[model samples]
Target: MTSIEPITLTGKFVTLEPLSQEHHHGLVDAARDGDLWKLWYTSVPTPEGMAAEIDRRLGLQSQGTMVPFATRSNTTGKLIGMTTYMNIDAETPRLEIGSTWNAASAHGTGTNPDSKLLLLRHAFETLGCPAVEFRTHWMNQQSREAIARLGAKQDGVLRNHSRSKDGALRDTVVFSILEHEWPAVRNGLEFRLAKYSA
Candidate 1:
């Protein structure tokens, strides 16, 4: 089965670098921006857990089931979050883009959209993926909205999808953008970024 490889993806607002131990401290600071770990529905790690999270992602990469990236602000050149291509099915040439979180300060900026643009471009044009999936906890309305803003259609809700760190049942909301839908989504992202550019 073919697998996605770790590679740097750059854009005007953000850059997705292959996740590494070197990004540890920067991510800690980023997580501290909004005390992101306090959000119960998400899995943003605390400062001390940053290294372990990086290790976990790297371990998955080693197993050839995931390709992770540390998101960085192109202007500040600081690590702002993490994202990944996971649940890889090389036979179907599909993957899920999740485990993504950005610093609160980076929210509402062009960072997220630009990052998605770069990722989707790579997944479709480079990786030749037929579909890219996104999943978020149902309680995480903000995340669900963000994914929708990217032009992905909600596939459905997975009830009792998994257990959260807090031991609460999580309803997973699934969204996707098929290969045929990429162009329109790409154009929307471009238009969104252009507004920020000006």
Candidate 2:
């Protein structure tokens, strides 16, 4: 089983740097842009909770369960969001790319797909992961559509999967891209990103 290490993943639109408390101010500003913490379906951190969020993710990393990153806009060179490779099963070399949220301003700017490209490429090509999973609240229609657009196939829905931030019963929509599907998924991501380049 290969252990996940912290490394910088740079892409054309955004760069994913190992998450740190140093990013506190920038992330607070980013979250404020969208008031992301107010989203009932997501777990984005509030300005006051930014440090705790960073600490929580870092603590998980120490437990060998997650590798979190601060997403920065390459063009603006500022922190715009955070993401992670969580629910790791290093023995099977599998992981779920969850706990991701970007500044509302970064939406539709190719940051999400670009970030995915880096993470997926590393997981499949470098880590030899058999599968990469994604899970989202069933009611988060926007997120569901975005995941589907990535070319991942739906595995199934986990009913009453957990509780949302607002304490609502949540159904988790699970999706995955297997090793064999990476080629096509990569192509789709590269194609989407190419448009941004041109």
Candidate 3:
């Protein structure tokens, strides 16, 4: 599929739409909830920052290195978050789900888990990728725990991986799910969704 084509991936509870201008306003509204970007390790902090972020992601897409999405809750038809496949190695059939942020309403709900299931299904089954990666700041306890719940194995920590927005040195926590591990990961996600729904 052409990278520019509007890709729509839906799971039982969430849908991922290819990032577009139409999604900008809704995402901004969703992000209006406070301190979103205040987290030292998170990418976004304000609605105004989204435009530049969107442009950056689109620029990467032009180079075939990233695909970003505006996450919507299928149940409520509300824009809830954003996610992306970054550092995409199409030749090696691998991509990373990073630069992710969710509205407060999305947390502790089925939105994130189901959103991930939809993306993972596309990455592994549709794209036929051999692996998928999920990375977070090493000290981001919430993100680290969420990644673990996805059944991804912690590969290792990349110390001094990058500079954080706050100018602090970042230690990256890397995790991955190999093709051979998709079955269990998929099942775990389904279970998590079920629990959320129940």
Q: What is the C-alpha local distance difference test score of each model?
A: 0.92, 0.95, 0.85
| Tens-digit lDDT string for candidate 1 (91-146) | 78899999999999999889999988999999999999999999999989999999
Q: C-alpha displacement of 175 in model 1, angstroms?
A: 0.6
Q: List the residue pairs that clash in candidate 3.
A: 37-44, 37-45
After superposing candidate 3, which stretches have Cα over 4 Å from the reference? Answer: 1-6
All models, RMSD in angstroms: 1.0, 0.9, 1.9
Candidate 2 ranges with C-alpha deviation above 4 Å: none
Assess the local accuracy of residue 64 in candidate 1 as a C-alpha lDDT between 0 and 100.
84
Candidate 1 Cα RMSD after full superposition onto the native fold (Å): 1.0
Shift of residue 153 alpha carbon in model 2, Å: 0.5
Per-residue lDDT tens digits for candidate 2, residues 36-84, read 9998887899999999999999999999999999999999998999999
Q: Report how far off residue 193 is in candidate 3 (Å).
A: 1.1
Error of 2 at 120 (Å): 0.2
TM-score of predicted structure 2: 0.98
Candidate 1 achieves a global lDDT of: 0.92
lDDT order of candidates, top first: 2, 1, 3
The local lDDT score (0 to 100) that residue 10 gets in candidate 1 is 88
